[model samples]
Target: MTLDVDEIERLYAYPATERPWVRTNFVSTLDGAATGTDGRSGTLGGDTDTRVFALLRSLSDVIVVGAGTARDEAYADYEVDTDLRGRLGLSPIPAMALISRRLDIPQHLLVADNLVVTTADADPARLATLRESVEVIAVGDGEIDWPDVLTIFADRGWTRVLCEGGPSLHGELVAHDLVDELCLTIAPILAAGGAPRISHGAHTVDQQMRLAHAIEADGGLLTRWVRDRDR
Candidate 1:
C-alpha cells in the first residue's frame, strides 16, 4: 500500500528528547548487498524508498556524510524548500557536512555552502581552495574523533543529525556509540554480485538494537531500529 504524506511523516517522526538524536538511513538488497553493479545505493532502492528518503531529508536538521560517499554520490547543494521549511518551522535547508582527512571533495560541492569536518593534518593547499567556498572545522589529527564531531554538532544546535553512509562512516558512528537509530530499507531485489554490507569497518562493537517498526510497500521492507539503551 502506498503511504500518504501524513502517514509517512507519522511513521518516521521522532519524539521530543532531551538531547540531539542521530539516525542513519540506508538501503540494501535481500542478498545483503548495500550496492548494485553501479556501486551506489540508489540502484537498490525502489519508488517507496525514494519517498522515505526524501521525507528523511526534509525532517533532518543536518545531513552528515562521509567524503567518499559525497564524492561517489556527486552530492549537490541542498536546495531550500521554503514552503516545507515554513510548515516545519525549520531555520533553512538542512546543511551538508562532509567528513574527510584528504579534503578531496567534489569541486562543485566545495563551492556550495557546506561544512567540511576534517582533521588538522589535512592537506593545507586543498583546504585553502575549499575554504574559499565552504567552512572548515578541524577536530582531530588524522582520523576524525567521532565524539568531538558529535559535540560540535550538538554545540551548534544541529541536534537532528541524519547520516547517509558509505558504510565506513556508519561503522565509526556505531563504534563510538553515537548512533541512536537506524532506518534501513530492504529492497526486494536479490543481488548476487559482491558488495559491502550496511556497516563495514575494522572497529566493531556488539550493540543490541530493537525494531521500532516495520512497513511494507512496493515489495520492499522499510524498518526502523532504535538502540536498546538498556543493553
Candidate 2:
C-alpha cells in the first residue's frame, strides 16, 4: 500500500511548541542489520523509505546527526519546501547539526549556516580553522555532553530535532534516555554476519516504546514509536 504524504505528515507530527524534542529515524534490514555489506545504511532503503525520509526532513526544524554518519552519507546542503515550512510554522529551512568527538568532519559539510556540536578539548587549530566558516558550539571538555546539545537546541528555538544516525549517536541518545520518538523502516532483507543493530553500544539501556503506528509499503515496513514515558 502507498502512504499518502499528508497522512504520513500527520503520523509523524510533533506538538506545536518550541520545546526540545528528539526523534531518531533509521532504516534497517529484517535481520536487524543497520548496514548492508556495503557498510552503509543507504543500501537498505527503497523508494518508500526515501519519501518518508524527505517527509520527516520537511517536518523538522533542524537535522542533528553524528559526524561519522554525515561523512559516510556524504551530506550536502538541503533546500526545504517553503510551502511546507509555512504550513509547519517552521522558522527556517531545516538547519544541519553535526555532533563530533574526534572533530574529523567533511569540509563540504562545513557550510557557514550549519552547526557543529563538539567538545572543548577538540583540536583547537582545527576548530579555529572551521570557525572561519561554521558556527561551532562546545558542550564538554573531553566528550560531547548530550544534555548540552539539548540546551543549545532549545536556546536556538529549535524544538523539532531529527536525528539521522550512524547508530553510535542513537546509542548515546538512547543511553541518556533523551530520545522521545523513533521512526524505523524495516527493509525485507537479511544481512547476516557482523552487522550492527539500529543502536550499538557496550552499555545497555532498556527503554520501552509504544508502537504509535506502522505502515507497510514497497515490501518494507515503516514503524513509528514513542518512548513509554509512563513506564
Candidate 3:
C-alpha cells in the first residue's frame, strides 16, 4: 500500500491508547544520503514524506534522538502547527530528549522541557550546565544505565515515547528490549558508504521483527513491525 502523507497523518492521529509507544527509525543510503548527494534527509524525502515525519513528531509526547543524530541532523526546535496539535490529540509541543554519556548539548537546540540522560560519573560542571538548561537525570552507575533511563522517562509520564534513531541508539534500545514498535523508512537509493546501516545490533534472524505493514512513500518504503512477544 502507498502510505501517503494523509494516511501517515491519520496513522498518528489514531488514539494513543491504540498505539501507546511508537518508535520511528530511518536510515538513508551511504555516500551523503538522506539529502541527495548533498547530505540532508529533507532533500531525499518528498513533500509527503516530510509531512508524515512532521506529523509523527507532533503526535509523539517525547522525541528521543541520540547525541550524534542531534549533531549530524543539526537538530532544531520542534514546532507543531496549532491546528495539527488538536487534530492529533497532542500537546502544543513535544519534549526533546537526548541520550548521551556526556552533557555536550547545543544551546540553540535546547527547549523548555529538554531531557538529558547521562551517567552518574559524568563531569560535574557539564552536569550542572545540563541541569540549568533542562531536566537532567542520572541513570546508571557507569556512563549510562539503560534500565534507569527507561525508569526516568516512565516517571515523567512518558507512556508513549517515540525514539528517532541514528543506529547506535537503536541498537541499544533493541538490545535491552525497550522498543515496543518500530517504524522504519527505507529509501530506494543505495550509497556505498558514509553512514551505518539501519541497525547495528547483533540479533539473529529469529530475533528480528515481523512486519505489520509495508507502505510505499515517494520512491521509498515505510515498514512497520512489532517485536515477537515470545522472544
The lDDT leader among the candidates is 2
Model 2: per-residue Cα lDDT over 86-156, one tens digit each: 97678667888988977788988888778899998888998898888899988787778888878878897
lDDT of each: 0.83, 0.86, 0.68
lDDT, model 3, position 116: 79
Question: Mind sharing the TM-score for model 1?
Answer: 0.93
lDDT (Cα, tens digit) per residue for candidate 1, span 113-218: 5799988788889878888899988878767877787777778777788999979889878888879999999999888977889888887689889998888988
Model 3 misplaced stretches (Cα beyond 4 Å): 1-6, 12-22, 30-36, 87-89, 201-206
In terms of TM-score, the best-performing candidate is 2
Clashes of 2: 0
Q: Which stretches of candidate 1 lie over 4 Å from their true place?
A: 79-81
Indicate the residue-level lDDT of 227 in model 2: 81
Query: In candidate 3, what residue range of length 10 has the lowest lDDT sum?
Result: 13-22
Native-referenced Cα lDDT, model 1 = 0.83
